[model samples]
Target: MGFKSKRKIKTNFVSAANKKLRLAWDRKHRQLTVSDWRKWVFSGKTRVNMGGSDSESFYWSDVPGTNRPHQVRPQVQGISDGVMVWGCISGDRPGYSTAIIDGAIDSNKYVEILKTSLMQTLE
Candidate 1:
């Protein structure tokens, strides 16, 4: 099966496709806005705020004390998936966002996309 055809896509236009997917992820999600897709990226996964101190912002800690920081939190990832509005900006209002977050969170497709995106970006 073709890599892309395996997916059920709508409005099959490259220029608008990415935007559509992003908006889809924004409509249903409550925390991470469509603008925060960067966090779902593998590069961002390791760098996002896990949970350390009670600072206003996300911080990374590698200390050997009682308050050692954790830089990796799957809950954040779950939140990312939950708040994902997969296909937005296609509704009424013409630039409207979607509320669909039906992507396989831990499926091969998820891994493949992230791996592919990471390779292209990091490599």
Candidate 2:
């Protein structure tokens, strides 16, 4: 006779997230109005923020072999480059897509971009 494999029984457990989502659905179901939607659209105060970032590696790595371990030397090829873009939009108004070119986005650089690009976009 063949031995039967022991399998775990599946459980349908409702987590805290499921409870919260169900409550939110129950509260918001057919409760929104046209005026509420219009206000939300015009205010541009949505729950989501739009943002993006791009990066490029300046150094290359040698392919690793599974047979044995090897020590690799690091090389200074060039500067690590990257850029970040972000913006928001309202119903009729368009937003600005600001891009900052830097290796790291610190507070000082962030403020600089806001002062330069963001201010220009606002104007």
Candidate 1 Cα errors over 4 Å, as ranges: 1-63, 68-80, 86-94, 104-123
Weakest ten-residue segment in model 2 by summed lDDT: 41-50
Q: Write the per-residue lDDT of candidate 2 for residues 31-114, one digit (tens) a residue.
A: 876655534321112112122222222333465453322343333446443355545444435655556554456788767766
- The C-alpha lDDT values of all candidates are 0.41, 0.51
Write down the TM-score for model 1: 0.20
TM-scores vs. true structure, each candidate:
0.20, 0.32
lDDT score for residue 115 of model 2: 77
- What local lDDT does model 1 show for residue 69? 40
Give the per-residue lDDT of model 1 (tens digit) for 5-82: 243434445667888888887787757656574434322111123343223334445564444344443334444433
Name the Cα RMSD for model 1: 20.1
Largest lDDT belongs to which candidate? Answer: 2
- Please report how far candidate 2 places residue 7 from its true position, in Å: 24
In candidate 2, clashing pairs total 0
